[model samples]
Target: MEKITPKVDIAFKKIFGVEENKDLLIDLINATVAPEDQVVEVTILNPYNPKSFSNDKLSILDIKAVGQTGKRFNIEIQITDESDYDKRALYYWAKLYTEQLKVSQNYATLNKAIGIHILNFISITDSKKYHNVFHITEKESGLPYFTDLELHTIELSKFSKD
Candidate 1:
């Protein structure tokens, strides 16, 4: 019998996007995100649904969760290379961050938004590292401008079985 890979979008969602498997998702998030911001618990905002598979192609299978610390995480697995993948990730992160605030809500009410992109192909070809974290910072001062927005890319192609 052939084993199905969790790297596939649907399989990934079924494994990590359900309420019962929240522990797995938390563990994954803790391992992927910065150690300082590690979360012990998380609430799946969009749990998996078997009925949605028929319309899967028309929608994103990303997992959305909120940590105990109030931080939001968007985890996605991408197998194919899309030219606008980077921009789309940023846009989703920004949307999630801004959407936290209501019409009369203050800007301070917004929580940190983190995006984790698991890619089957190399995104940053120049680097040998499989994992990369991105943040907004001042170019001249090398100081972080905004720490609320974080993006992580994990290239599966760089992983070794050993």
Candidate 2:
């Protein structure tokens, strides 16, 4: 018997990036989402197939999908800590959000883009918690003003360590 390191980029992709294991993905995702916005089903946009994993182990292996509620989702697992990782998450979220609309599509047609980043390092030092959800809210009241954009950061190091 050998130890399987799921935290590795390719292993993580292989586990959750396929359509067959969508239930596992949905369950994991549901734990981080609100009860009202819980996802029952998701259509995987970029699925992983072992037949052609490519020679590159560091290829962009984000699990892209759309939930049953018309919300777009981008799930990425980062084992190696990178500089400006927060910005990278935001950039990916923005790219996914903006790409929904075309030259003729109405603004209202755009759905919510949710970015789920699983990091093996500590990104947000302010919070001691392992999981953090970000949204655009009112500064004074702290009420949610915008619900279209949501970002989730799950720091694995904090969870397994502290």
Candidate 1 Cα deviation (angstroms), residue 13: 0.6
Query: Model 1 over residues 81-136: C-alpha lDDT tens digits?
Result: 89888987887687667657768888888889999999998888888889999999
TM-score of each: 0.88, 0.85
| Candidate 1, pairs of clashing residues | none
Top TM-score model: 1
lDDT of 2 at 11: 78
Q: Model 2: per-residue lDDT, tens digit, 1-162?
A: 988787876777678878779898898778877787679999888433122245833224378888987888888888888999988888778777776787999899999888899898999999988989999989999999778989999998889542
lDDT of residue 87 for candidate 2: 87
Q: For candidate 1, what is the lDDT?
A: 0.84
Question: Which run of 10 residues does model 1 get worst, by summed lDDT?
Answer: 48-57
What Cα-based lDDT does every candidate model obtain? 0.84, 0.81
